[model samples]
Target: MNKVFLLSLYEEAVRVSKPKHCLPQYFNAFSKNDRVCVLGVGKAAADMAVEAHNYFGSNAYGLVVTRYGYENTESTGNIEVRLAAHPVPDENSVTGANALLAAASSVEPSESVIFLISGGGSSLACAPPSTVSLEQKLSLHKFLLRSGASIEEMNTVRKHVSVIKGGRLAAASKGQNTSLVISDVVGDDPAFIASGLTVQDTTTPQDAIAILDKYGFDNASPLRGYLANAPLLPKVKGDYKLVANAQSAIDAAVEMAKASGFSTRVISYTEKGEAQEVAKRHAQIALECKQQGKPILLFSGGELTVTLGDSKGEGGPNQEYLLALTKYLDGEPGICALAADTDGVDGSKDVAGGFIDESTLRNAKRKKIDVNAMLAEHNSFGFFESLESHIKVGPTRTNVNDFRVIYVS
Candidate 1:
């Protein structure tokens, strides 16, 4: 398939997984008269709340926290919409967290508390404990992001430090609580998605400390002490359901490819590890497909990490994944690939991700962009920008982790 068709398939994967399309099925299960205190958290939170409002009418009214620029004010009926810092928490994140807690706690026993949780909710729904200040939490967030911690490990620390996470939000409410989640984690475990705001948290503070120690984070004594003394979440009752995830998006993309007459195979759904390492492994798979001399589409989905350390580069994990793939392939013919965060933002950049084919590096060299230097600095965005190879889709208002496609023809 050509680049246009391949990119369209990726877009289809995202659109099919959007909150506006998938949430209504779950919303219809709840009673129409149920007073819903909706706590929408993630990039898709506001859009999810709007779907709930459309179904429940005036019964749905609560706080929603999405990434900046994603809060849809026009269609957000009854529900209160707010913006907060993502990938890192800010003062406004604390404010939004408090509002979500107050809204949940103030509900009557007969009311139904619904949490629309997704990826990025861990930072968006921030409510640090009294012992940990907002500034301290911010510092810790930055440290963990740079520490190369997995989503599970980062959330292990997040749940202990935050009051709203680790099922504490559900404990505060004496109503029927249900969490409709869009899973971005590898296993699609509800607990890791947004740190399990409404689900039961089995991990203790010691678990959080263990994760911190494993990473050798600097000056974590104060944070460790806080976790050591932190109170456990009160036993709470709630229901958690996975409405969308990486596997679902990958399946959609695979189906699209098959319909277009390409021999498609789902390589994996829960792939993980460092971005560059994963890219090298995937490039090997593509090489195998090319050697077989048949048109084939390889599909995979998972979130990959980029350890920034001190490297100040303007790119996300998906960009790094593709750039590294190009280096490994070395302009191998008949191989084309695309990698992107289904949420429409990769790492800290607005671009969804980058695209690469056999000529990607050659095109970059013509522009005098040194791919090696850019890769060394983790500056994949700069490299792709020079070649106009980055995919820009804005916010699709849904996140199901990273979507990747490799075509060998």
Candidate 2:
């Protein structure tokens, strides 16, 4: 029953953020007669495009670029869907970026251009400047992922290196532009979501350079030289709306928990930091709730980072968080937890996340699993898989970052 309740809360969070549920209401602002050209990019791009196509019918036509394997099968007659690599951009990412730029540039002044932007757009539609080779950009991305940098810091560097991000797409358009964003970053800032494809950028190239320097990135790269003389980003005129965000998902989960008669506390809607460290903090909170001697639910949202260093982890942040959490929990009775990405993919793995309970440590002991060694190697996926505790829900079609729930009684 605990497992069922926890999974339901996650489902509720994902459901509310999906484009079909949250996007159509925003479309009422545009007239049916208006000429619509939609450009969608990110994990949720295809679904957002399909929603626009449904609303505008014959009038809406454009392109969508999404992470590979995230395409929606829903009929979008005039809208083209292109798949690209994510986390690290590839050749397909360049192709998608160019296509999106061309489509944005071709929009007539009389037309209404709508950008459906979400998480993963930074890599799914990468278009670096000529001075930075694709190989260099890829290396930078790989380093940042393991550098323990915050999403804001990583995207700060990305905005400076890319030609299509940092409001360049909106700058290319001749039409009145509007951005409907599903924010995966904390604070729901449109400027950082998908690296702000349709919104004007306030961060400078120096800001990117500073972030790279703070992360101990190689100083001799040619990209640093390009950043030294990078052109100022153009100011774009556009309407930006955050249709869904981590807060939205958290709110939904709160309602569900309340309905289930659990005393609920929302620790935060904007969580960050290293996965294991964050887990240690949350474990202390769980213990406090356990002492209260009443049924309670603790919730949090926001993306967490994992600094891989020398160890090649087989797990993403969510799984790693759970593994570390189980250790701190120490098989405490009447406590269980779940941590998952709302977008369905956690880290680079196909698994959503993991589930843990009071029996988890005992189960591992019975199986003779070396929990400490697995955690040290960043192999939380293997740890959970050995116990059959990992959750797998492929491509929820929306991303509002990570969703976590802890239940104590």
Candidate 3:
């Protein structure tokens, strides 16, 4: 019953953000005679393109770039879908960016362009400047992922290094632009989503340099030279709408918890920090809730970071959070919790996340699994897989960052 209830909350959180649920009402942005060009980028790109294609029918034609496995198999009228690597950009990412730039440039001044932007767009539509090779860009991504920098900070650096990011895409377009965004970052700022693809950029190259310095990159790094010569981005105009976000998912989960007869408290809709440290604090809250002896549910959203200094692990932030949480929980009864990315993939693993309850620690001990060692090595996926406790929901098709729920009864 606990598992069922927790999973239900996750499903409800994801359902509200689907393009079908949140996009149609915005269709008024297009008109009968307008030539429509749809551009989409991110894990939700294909799905959002399908929605746009359905609304505009044969009149809509453009390109969409998404993660390799996240393409929507459903028939989309005339939009072409391209697959690319994420978190780490590949050659295909460059191709996707060039294609999108061409599409945006070809739009007539009288036509209207729709930009379907979402999380993961940063990597899915990468276009590094000629001074920097794809290998260097890939290395920078690997460093940032392990550096514990926040999404905004990482994208600040990304914007300065890329050709298409930082409003360059918007600058190339002749059509009036309208961006429909699914926000995965806390604060949901348009300037940071997909590194402000269709919006104006306010960040300077020095900002990217500062982020690099903060992350321990030496002054001698070639990126510093590249950023030093980075051109200023032109001011651009676009109507940016946040169609879905972490807050919406949290609101839906709160409603479901009330319907389930549990009093609920929202810890935050913008939770952020290191995974283990956040888990420790959350564990304390869960323990306090249990002591009160009343049915209660706790909810939070926002992405967490895992700084991998030396350990090479098969897990994401959500899985790491759950693993750390299980240690702090220490098999406490009447409490169960789950943490997962709303996008369905947590870290680079196929698994969504992990789950834990009163019996988790005990079961680990019985199975002779060393929880402490696993956590230290950042191998949460391995630990959960050994116990068959990880959640696997392939490509939810939308990303709103991390969703966490804790229930005490």
Candidate 4:
């Protein structure tokens, strides 16, 4: 496997998430009314707002909440950009959450309400439950981050705790509401994306409680009471559109590889599960494709979760997935692969993610790094650093979950 070409596939996936290419189609379709409110929440919200401002002129005005480094609202004239915490809710997210409810308060039956929802919005844009404090929410969010809880599980709990999630924002709009969503989930399920802030949620508060328990996320703190007395949401159905998804990243990677004269095939955009387990499956698939004389490129994009079991590790799902695959592969064949998050931030760390091939195992071993021990610690970043394979892109201002490319030829 050629590591140089494999890394290019990762770059191409990220390049597609930029504003100009993947965003304009959705932004252009949205016609802003003079009396419209264009509020948003997610990693891409601020960037969406900026484009909305440019497309609709000064008429579109509203607020958007994003992680600290993910905002792209530098020159938005009419729109307000709010930075908040993500993967964990802090006071800022509480403020942003309150702002979300506040932003949706002034809706009228005749006025157009344009809601921009995207991945990472659940934690980035939040309003805590009446019985819960921001600190409590933050603590719980931190636990979930390291708990290996799936996005569905994490969001299920979030929907009940949030005053604006689980269709509450749509309920807030009350009148004419239209939501433009950029999904970072498999199949682009709006309910799971951003906890369905602007869409209706069929999952009950009981479901939320069940998920928290199912994952053994039961922290005997302020959470028990908070979950017991979760928020009440109103039923609402609003216009929704899926503008971006994991498929977008996969398609982009395929094109980029093809442009460079390499055969590429999209394996799946619906890969999900624990990072290591999925990696093992993906590794086997790559080997099979190589042996069957169908040597080409394989791509996949989806969100994966890492369940931490009392381990101190500096890693995210993508990096962890790679570590698991490379360790098992152990230079078994000539397979090179690159995996990363499209948002350019894997987990809460700097740099998008990392890549590997046959030589990766040899390099890590020569560097005296225990690959299996690192995986056990969930420290894929450190292992990759030893191999100098960590890919860093800071914040791309857009997220469509993870992008993985397996080059067979």
Candidate 5:
């Protein structure tokens, strides 16, 4: 197990999870004359829309909102493309949300609205309720991300504060709704993906309040009253399909590992928790695997949280996971690991993730880099960048959360 082998495994995992490969199969039954208006949103929205266009041709008409710099420069006829902020809502996000609502509203009842929902849509298409100002939403967004809340929890709060989320977008539409979702949340629940733009939200205002309180948001926070008075939308009749998810990506990685002549097992596709603790557990698994005296690969998928405890250096959860995992490995031979966000961006950084081998600690020591200190400051990116171990693949135009793989030989 080395950097090269680990990278190949990562590439194979991403290859199968690509939107072009995963989205087209789900659109076969959709009719070209169905008067479908596709509303694509998230990191993969542009690519997903392009695929839908291929199937529906001119029949497909609508809009796609993706993160800034994530739009497809290629042909996207009849489907308007808009760039917006992600992980945090901006003025552009509100504009995108308005456009989606307008498109959905103008369509005839005979027509169908197809929403291409993916990970970043929560912030990418922000339409805060009239009572909740954009600044309030943005402030809450920052608080939630730094609070180390899960995607489910964050979206739970988001749904309560938005005018277009938690099925409100679908509820506002006169036409039938259909969602072609790229899930990035645990359990692949459409309600949590992009804050459930088309799916019915079961979470109540109380639920949102509880999550905010659990994360230590002050009672003075504007979210308290907004959520308390926010109305929940009724579940609508619509076509909702899971086009791709973290499990699919993990399965692809496992298959690739087995084909490469290593025994492989997918431990869990929905693993979650604090990043450092998760890495320690994974390190223990590698130790046990090494003792078996057989080459083996262990793969898992799911987003991990990094509670930034005032030590703000530049790094995402994946990077923090790898840095912690490397320390636990303690220069043990025949063990290597890779962890990355499937969307090709980890946290707020441009890098995808980080790669670590048994020799990572040794290499860092030789380079006079203090691994522990870097980890303490949440500087995984800085540490990896100095060692040239940061994985950068740019945006993959598809997201299914985080992908992780460990190889032992």
Candidate 6:
């Protein structure tokens, strides 16, 4: 369980967890027709659209909105690619969102809309209602992210502020809207992934309002009123399919660990909640298992939300989880862990995530790095930076939320 070994296993897990390789397999049944539109809006939409084109060739036509640098670097002659802001709304997102709505609206009822819905679409591919400006949405999104709100809560707010969320895309399609979604939120609720653009939500305006109230934004949010007793739907509903999920990545990691000469078991891909707390629990579990006990390798695929207390330092939930996990370990032996977002970006920073072995904090302590203070500030990036342990993979251009792996040998 050294750094190199831990990194090798983690990288192997990440390579297997990608949305790019997984998306194409689901499109095999899709027919290349004379009138077919393939629209995507999420962190993985760009790659999803590319795969659709690869499968359907020129038969696919439509747009995909993604975070900047998340789009396919290679030009696709068929699918239109649009880049926009993420975790927050922006003018570019609005424009791209309009394109999707327009495309859906103009399509004849006989045509089929293949909607590629993945993680991060809720913010990156969004058009706030005409009454809500991009600035308002951006401010509120940022605010919500720091308020200890869950991904579901954040998207609940997002669905109300936008014109094309919570199955509105399906409503706009008028015809068939087939959703190929990658579950990110806990429980894989279709309504929360990218704000459920093509999936129906059973949540009511009360649910949305409750989220706002929990975040202490009930009075601040302009759309709070609209969320009270609002319709229990997206105006129209469509079919949804879970293409790939956290279990896929966790299973891959477990198989690879076994092949690498270590017995492994995948805990669950649906884990969620506070990052720091998650790290502590994982560390405890690893401690309880001696190397002879199947050499536990827990993998989780769901997204984790961090409630930033007073503008916490730069680091995503994955980073925070790792740093916090270290606090519980106290330099214990034969314990190593890796936590990262499947989308390749964590927090507002560019770092994907980082690696930690039993010696990680021991090494950091020698350098006089206050791990507790840094963790308290939720500044996992700064702490990792000081230790030169930050993992940077740039945008993997796909999203399945966060992927975590822990190994004991």
State each model's C-alpha RMSD to the native. 1.4, 1.0, 1.1, 2.0, 1.4, 2.1
lDDT against the true structure, per candidate, is: 0.87, 0.91, 0.90, 0.80, 0.86, 0.78
| Model 5 clashing-pair count | 0
Cα deviation at 398, candidate 6, in Å, is 1.2
Local error of candidate 2 at residue 3 (angstroms): 1.0
| Residue-by-residue lDDT tens digits, candidate 6, 114-184 | 89888888877778766666777777787788898888888877787778888887788877778888767
Model 4 agreement with the true structure over 1-409: per-residue lDDT tens digits? 5767777777666666665566667755555546678888998888888877777778887888888887673576678898987777677877887877877887777777888878888888778767777777777777777777878878888788778888888787755888888888777888889988987778877787777787676657777766776656678877888777778777877887788787777767888899999899888887788778777888888888888788878878899999999977768666777888888888768868898878888888788888889988888888887788987877888888898887776
Candidate 1, residue 177: the lDDT equals: 86
Relative to the true structure, candidate 6 reaches a TM of 0.94
Q: How does model 1 score by TM-score?
A: 0.97
Per-model TM-score, in order, reads 0.97, 0.98, 0.98, 0.94, 0.97, 0.94
Model 6 ranges with Cα > 4 A deviation: 17-20, 218-221, 226-232, 291-294
Measured on C-alpha atoms, candidate 4 has an lDDT of: 0.80
Q: Give the clashing residue pairs of candidate 5, or none.
A: none
Candidate 2, residues 40-125: lDDT per residue as tens digits?
89999999988998899878999999988899879776889999998899999999999999999999998999999999999999
User: For model 5, what is the error of residue 214's alpha carbon versus the real structure, in angstroms, after optimal superposition?
Assistant: 1.0
> For model 3, what is the alpha-carbon lDDT of residue 79?
94
Off by over 4 Å in 4: 1-4, 27-33, 229-232
For candidate 2, the lDDT comes to 0.91
Model 1 clash pairs?
Answer: none
Q: What shift in Å separates residue 206 of candidate 6 from its native position after superposition? A: 2.0
The stretch of ten residues in a row with the least summed lDDT in candidate 1 is 216-225
lDDT of 5: 0.86
Clash pairs (backbone) in predicted model 3: none
Tens digits of lDDT, candidate 3, 237-340: 87888999999998998998888777999998998899999999999998987887867888999989988887888799999999999999899988899888
